[model samples]
Target: MSLLASEDLAEGTHNVKQGLPDLLRNTHDVTSQWMEENTTKEETELNDWANLPHVVLENVFEQLNEVSLLRAQFVCKRWYDVIRHSASLWRDKSFRFSGRDPRDLTHGPYKYASSFTRTFGRYLERVEFKLFSPVTSSVCKKFQKCVKICLNSLIKTKAHLKDFSMPALQLDRSQWMLYREDMCSALARFFCKSQHTFERVDFPGTRANFDDGYKILYALGYNTGRTVTHLDITDMMISRRPMFDIPQFVECFKHFRCLQELELNYSYISEDLLEVLAANLQENSLQVLSTSVTQHDPHNQVIWGHSWAALANRCRDLKVEFYFQRVMTYEQHFRILLPQIPLSEASFDGCYFADRDWQIRPTIASILPRFQSTLERLIIELPDTREVFETELLSLLSLCPHLWYFKMSAYTSTRFLDKLLEAVSEKRCNLSVIKVRIYVRDYDTDHEEIDLERIYTKYRDLITNDLIDYYATCCVSM
Candidate 1:
């Protein structure tokens, strides 16, 4: 009788478990039915996005890029109204050329990008105009007109512009001359108005006369010298023809007291200019200076050791990059410059040493003691077939306690891999990254051969065997 009772209890429990799903389904159905019937009005009220606070809508619009913003305006009358009134939506806007002819400003995305500034220029803090496609003379003129319009709007609104990028105008010497004066005047006006707030100015591919360039620089010196930190005047065509008297050009740098990074290309550097720079660099504020020597300049003077020493004394943490053509020799320059400058990073490219007897190993070894603590990055590119063994290079590495990055392109023997591993192990160098391009000759075949795979394998072994705690890459050049 007790076994039967236990079976009955089990049957009852099974029946209740089977009915549990039905009970839950009924409850859910009732609740959902009630919600459907009663909450329609509340749902409609909650769906009113237009009723959201203005600030919230502004934030949503800010996330949309320029193209999306144009489409977003057509959503409804209320959204259109929100977008029109929200001036902050246009702040920090960038206008990029989308491979369209600048003259066709009435059509395509350029129309919108160019015209938006007319309406919302007051709210702009940072404006960048990048011309990715090349422009014809007519298109450049039209582009200049648009820039002038934007500058006028900024001036009218009294907007404190922070960053400005001159379009990468790929104009020939003649085309540059056509619009140079007008652009310089407009830029000077803009700089005069926004000097206090300007931080970066990039002129990637633009040309001007020396007078126009001087006017622009004078405006920068008088107005934005202290405020502007990063200035790039690369590939600037000062004239249709070359002007060897770059001393006047160097005079403009005296006013850039607060500059952190300066880049100039296709310019002449003379001893007088170096002396001026040494005297005028505003309290050791300059950090990075990159310039290329004008090739075949009759007026090019040898940079004396004292001039470099004076500049180096003021700018202790300066990183110098000297780009030279085959016309100049680097050994004499480095001999004078390296010992004076407490450089953190240095790069020498396309430089040929006049003194055939001068070896890089000795020059580097001489400066290792002076630069050990400060030097972190070193790049040397010389294709000379001189063999540099591990033993000679290891001494230089041992002195550079803070060295983190090294790149060299030169000729070396098979023992270079073994020697590098040995140096990293023995000296305990702080090299975290290294890239080498070594040219090796197949002596038996009397031809150049580069076994990249073997070098990579050896580098991998160095890391795997705990010989170096860094990233290493090796390339072979034949």
Candidate 2:
């Protein structure tokens, strides 16, 4: 028996039993008989309200949605006491708007709850923001208002905005009067309102003209301290104005000494701009840097010339990435800086085709042999061509013994794939993931889609059963 139960039996037997005399017993009996008749009113009034399963009720309340949960809180003081003490019940309810709805009542109501629930919700350790925008101006106004309200609510609650994506967007100047200014204002308001709470910021669009839009970000990054971790700003058309203001922008990053991963999208960066940005980030000791740019043509006068070569040499310790149309020229540039720093991963999307006006495919394959030993992941996004996956492409890949991941897309023939796989049979490194975007018929309308199934089946066996025990391989056709 438990200690309390055993102790209770011992106390009752020793104190109430074997101690009374015969006369005392008879007197006590007479007194008890009299008392039983009149003392019924004085018997301990048993309060059975506390007998209900309170722990079960607490669990059910936790499973309920926001609206149901609020109803439960009003059920009784017992419930209020239980839930008020439970902090984790509020952490999982934070959600972002669909971006399409203007007055979305359901978007972020957790952020707008009473101060008690709000305080509890601030303990959230993970958050994901899925960004979408309205198609028309009327809807846009409503959507913008919704976002503003949500932001206000979040700020009031002091919600921990962990991961957020603005989903980089491109706006046309003709769409509205002072469009850029309005966007900049919105961005500035967003940053200013939730500067401390917002941690990860993703610019979803590949290209954007830098203006006041960038300044708001600069200000936020400058003051937010080390909370920011991953920053993706790839494929952006950064205007020259933003380019000129880069020194100030970079200085802002110096304040965010905790930045780890940085991405630069489609930026035609000059040598000086690159040098400044790299120096600032390196001072902060960033681990990953991804960059994309249109490759310079010898015939075109837009080349960065020797300036880019210099920046590449300087940022040797950084994990550098470059995406371009002509992989050959980019590889050539990379080769010059390869000696200075060990660039481990490189992606070549949209290879040059001689017949399709991208006339540098021949030169690109020649440079692949140079990156064989050091390159970790080599992604080749092929263009639609009759003889795109030629013998020369397979031969170039055979040189990379250290290559862990290899992928090709856009209508590569089955026979060519077999040959390529056969060639890499022995030299295959520690490949873990491969994604292939399949070819589909072009559509004039917006409803067109790619055949993901066929692409997966084509390379299914090759990627499914990976060689490594802990490594997993996956392929996406679209």
Candidate 3:
């Protein structure tokens, strides 16, 4: 009886132990499956585009164009909310009104001018006026009226007009003669009125008489002095009136306390004006200055080297560009000016360096040393006949430890490319980009058969294996 009872109890205990393992295994499997499903659901919710943060949606909307944004506003309620709340999307609004039709000027049933201003004008930070076919008197009158209406709308809307650009008034000789003064006065009034908030004013292809130019300058100096940071008066036709002297004209620059970039293409820059600029330029704010110099008689002209040197010294971050229309001996001028400025960027375009006395290497050498610590960008375009020395080029590059962007059009051999790579390695130069258009002599067979692909492969190897990152583009010319 005892043995039978003991055997039955042992069999019962073994059955319980075996069944417990299966029960625990089944419980673990169900728990794991539930956890995986919950995790997947959470991840899907997190990655859903509709659940993106408001700031992210705003940023996405900022990249959309006006037409795309207008269409996007109707996509859904959430998108509409994002577009409406995103201030960045409406920060720098611009309004354009083309004066191709006389009816555009009138406040007819369409209310073309006022409707645009009333709806979107409050957000405008820029205004552009494009008047076409201003040849006939009627068209000219309409254009002028449209401009007035636009200006009045801007004033009424109280939009912060930071950038203002106007195309040149196209008119026939008779039309120009009839309306030049009135147009000048109207433009002057607009500038004067909007000067307080204007940060950039571009009046390309505008022809102005001496009086008009003076008025523009006066408006800039007195009204917009503290706010205007960028000014482009490219292709402005100044009357050859003897009454408007350079000294009086340059007096306006003295008031430019906030001017960071000034471009005066095809404008007269006399020695007296340079002197005035040297004395009065906003050193802390003036970062870019570009002008064209046309000195037909280099001998009789007053030397501007000292003034330029002074300017360069005072404005350490200045990127001075001089576009010479006439080929003259500018070596002396550059020699004096380059050593004083810590040029962060320099561009010389259409400059003739084939002059007998133009010692390119020495002039560049003198300039490169001072620019070594700060120079980041350089662009030089020279005559194809001008020779470029490898040693001088290497020396110049070695000095620029922080040169990230380089562009040059010159006569250089293939050895220069090798030397450039070696220099970058030796100097530990952080060169992110290099673009060279080398005019190699046909007889110089050393680089005539150069495999650019092989060079690029080498560059890629350096990037991948050595962790040196840079992009280089080399083109050969004969």
Candidate of highest TM-score: 1
Stretches of model 1 off by over 4 angstroms after superposition? 1-48, 51-62, 76-89, 98-110, 132-135, 167-172, 237-251, 265-282, 294-299, 315-317, 323-338, 351-373, 381-394, 409-414, 437-478
| Model 3 Cα lDDT, one tens digit per residue, 1-478 | 7999999999999999999999999999999999999998997875575568999988888888978997988877878877765656766644343445556445451355446566566677876776655545655565566566667676676778788877665432455666667776767776676637888887766766667766777776787778889887755546554322456677777777777888775245556666666676666677887755444312233344566676667666677655544333446445334454445665555454355654456646665567687677766676444655568667777667777776767777556666676556555556656676666445544543454445655565454554334443434443
For residues 260-368, could you state the per-residue lDDT of candidate 2 as single tens digits? 6777643334345555555554453556666664453221223353544454454444565655555334334444333433456666555435234442355446555
Residue-pair clashes per prediction, in order, are 0, 14, 0
The collision pairs in model 3 are: none
The global Cα lDDT (0 to 1) of model 3 is 0.63
* Residue pairs of candidate 1 with colliding backbone atoms: none
- Candidate 1's clash total is 0
Q: In what order do the candidates fall by TM-score, top score first?
A: 1, 3, 2
lDDT of each: 0.65, 0.52, 0.63
Better of 2 and 3 by lDDT: 3
The C-alpha TM-scores of every prediction are 0.71, 0.63, 0.65
- Candidate 2: C-alpha RMSD to true structure equals 12.4
Candidate 2 is scored at a TM of: 0.63
